[model samples]
Structure formats: structure tokens, C-alpha cells
Target: MNGVLFDSFQHNSWATKVLLKVCSQLSAEQLATTAVGSYGNIIATFNHIILSDARYLHHLSGNAPEWLLNRDLSNDFAVLEARADEAANNWQQFFTQPVDGEQLTILVSGDYEIHAGALIAQALHHSNIHREQICAILTSLGIEPPDIQPWAYAHETGRGRDLPSEQ
Candidate 1:
């Protein structure tokens, strides 16, 4: 289960990078353009993704991430990308160490107790949904969003080729 979770995190990070690469091609105005049915615009959605990941990291690590707190959504693309990279690294590091999935409890709104693994899974799913929303926004803007499928990430990272042949 830990291995699967770790792989999913890697996939999420890969997809984020691909999306950011496509976002890099757009002008500031295009990145900030409002799209219906999205959290805000491309940049705002990206910021939400980053900050949410940071919050998850804080929950997992038990240390609040000061840098991610109180951030404005209007940050430039480069800054957001850098912050995303940092958040991804934090998640990767957490997965690298031994995680007591059953022992870690996340306090939800200071009332409910939830497993850390569940929260991580929720974060992963949430990110994917937001990524799709970003893709839709990009499409509406006449820009083709980059491919962010897990298979594409596996192929790009040489993991797909690593599987044994069925022959």
C-alpha cells in the first residue's frame, strides 16, 4: 500500500510538471484569464494545488509550513512552480521514510480523527480533479494542455519499459 501511494505521488508530481511546462508557454494574462467552472484561473488553480499539498505535508510532518501560509494567489508563474517543486519534494521525502500509516491520525477541523493515509489519498485525488479542471480551462482558452496521464508519466520516466513482458 505504501509503495502504491508513493508511486501515485510521483505520478502526481510528474503530471504537475507537465502542466506547468505548458503553462510556461502562456503569457501572464492568459495564465490569469478567468474560466468558468474553475476555482479561478490557471494560476489560481495552480496555487490551490500547491498550497493544498503543502497543507498535507504539514499534516504528515506535524510541522507547519510557514512559507506556504498566507500566500497570495496572484504570484508569478515561476514562483508558483518553485513552490510546487518544494512541496513535491517534501511529500517524496515523507514517503521515503518509514510511515506508520495506522498510527498517524489527522485531526479534521479539530473535531474528527482520520487516518493519515486517507488524507493523503484524498489529497492525491483532489489534485487530479483540479488538474483536469485546469486542462478544461486551458482547452476553453484555445490552448492544448499537456498530457498528464499516469501512463505518460511512467513512459516518460522509463518505468513503463521496466515491466516484464507477458510473452
Candidate 2:
């Protein structure tokens, strides 16, 4: 009841928030570092991911958060985390609706329309790809990023329990 049946939105937010916290500890130069295949530096990538999330959520629910309009909350971890929280709440609210995946929705102004399910899928997929990019950047820096996989989210949030191995 908190979100969609699988609630990937919450996992998406949690995983990104976890990555954001890890990135917060980096020095300025480190944060600004980007790999050959990444989307700009860590800060810029985080900005893109969070802002795009707001946009996708806005398209879905018709409620736009201030970040989508303002676009000035850059590289500020506190602000980013707060914005992520607001986005998570909005997604939770959206999931509560009687949504139909087959319904058509406008992706962007004047852009072609797509199935409602595709929009949601894109949002989750986008967040994931960028997070891995950051992880790659971190690996290049010799830093081990925290595990933000769905299983890690499940373990941290008690969504799953492990059993001991048996012979």
C-alpha cells in the first residue's frame, strides 16, 4: 500500500540517497572527477538524476517540486537529500493512485506520448544507470562505494532475511 506493488521507487530513492551520502565525503577535486564513460562529474550526475526524477514524477502526478523549476540546488548534499525525500513522498502518493500501465502519458512538452508503464520504467532505469556510473567513478578513485543493490536495500530495510548455509 505504500507504493506500487513492487515499490521500485522507494528502492531507487534509497539507493541514490545511499550513493549521495558516499559522495558527500569526497573532497572537491574528487567530487569533480569523472571517468571516461560517465555523465560529467559526480555532482553533475547527481543533479541530473535527481532533477530528472522530479520531472518524471511531475509528468506522472502533475505536481512539480521546486527543484524542477529552480535548478539551483547543485552539489549541496543536504538539499539533494531533502529533495530526494520529497520526491520519494510524491512517488509514494502517486503509487497510491489507481494507476494503469497501459494508459498513455506525455513524456515531455510537445514530445510524443508513451505508455504510463514505460515512463515509470524509464525513471527507475535512469536512476540505476547513473548510480552505476558514479560507482565506476568511485572505483576509479580507489574508493569502494557502498552496496546499493536492491538486495542491500532489502537487507537494510528488513525486506528479506538470510538463512545460514547447510552442508
Candidate 3:
């Protein structure tokens, strides 16, 4: 389970980097321009992704980093990129160590019970959904979004490869 979870986190981080790299090419106006059906613009959407990961990590760890607590969504691209990188590194470190999968109660809007593993899965799913939305927004703006598929990520990272068929 940990291995799978780790892979998912790795893919998530890889995809984020790819998207951010593509977004870096956009002009300031494009980065901030609002698009229909998106959180706001490319920068805003990326900020949401970073903040969401921070919130989940805080719930799981019972400690919120000062930077995360005081994050500004409208910060410059470099700041947002650093925050996203930090969040990804944190998740990598977390899964590299042992995690307690036992059920724990958290107070969000209300008290809810969940396990560590489930929270990780939720984070991964949430990121992917938002990533797709960002991709759609990029397409609408006539900018080609980078491919973020997990299989593509695996192939790029050399962590996975096609196997020959057994006749």
C-alpha cells in the first residue's frame, strides 16, 4: 500500500512540475486571466492545488507550517512554485517513513473519521481532478498543456516499462 501510495504521490508531483513548466511560458496577463469553469486562472488553480495538499498534510500531521498557514494565492509564480515543490517534498518524505494507518478523527467542517491511507488517496484524486481542469483551461486559451498521465510519468521517470507478451 505504501509503495502504491508513494508512486501516486511521485506521479502527482511530476505532473504538477510539468504543468508549472508549461505555465511559466505564459505572459502575466494569461496567467491571471479568468477562464470559464476554472477556479480562476492558471496561477489561481495551481495555488488551490498547493493549499489543498497543505491542508490535508496538516490534518494528517497535526501541525501546520507557518508558510502554508500564511500562503498568498496571488503571489508571484516563483513563490507558488516553491510552495508546491515544498509540499511535494513533504509528501515524499512522509511516505518514505512509516505511517500509522489507524483510523483518526479530524475536525474539518465537523468531526470526521478517516485513515491515513484514505487521506492520501483522496489527496491524489483531488489533485488529478484539478489538474484536468487546468489542462482544459489551457486548451481553451490555445496553449497546449503537457501530458500528465501516470503511465507517461512512469515512463519518463524510468520507474516502469512495457513488458514483452508471453506467447
Query: Compared to the true structure, candidate 1 yields what TM-score?
Result: 0.86
- The residue-level lDDT of candidate 3 at 31 comes to 76
- Residue 21, model 2: lDDT of 93
| Tens digit of per-residue lDDT, candidate 2, span 31-97 | 9999998999999999899999988878877889876877755778998899888887888878877
| Per-prediction backbone clash count | 0, 0, 0
**Model 2 per-residue lDDT at 8:** 83
lDDT of each: 0.80, 0.87, 0.80
Runs of candidate 2 with Cα error greater than 4 angstroms are 1-6, 164-167
Residue 54 in candidate 1, Cα distance off native in Å: 0.9
The residue ranges of model 1 lying beyond 4 angstroms of the native Cα positions read: 72-74, 162-167
1-167: candidate 1 lDDT, tens digit per residue: 45667778889888887898888888888877876777888888888998888887787787545666665554676877777788888888788777876765755346667677788888898899899998998888888888899888878988786668899
Instruction: Give the per-residue lDDT of model 3 (tens digit) for 1-167.
Output: 56767778889888988888888888887777776776777787888998888778887876565776876565566777787888888887777767877757484546787887788778988889888888988888888888899989988999889999999
Candidate achieving the largest TM-score: 2
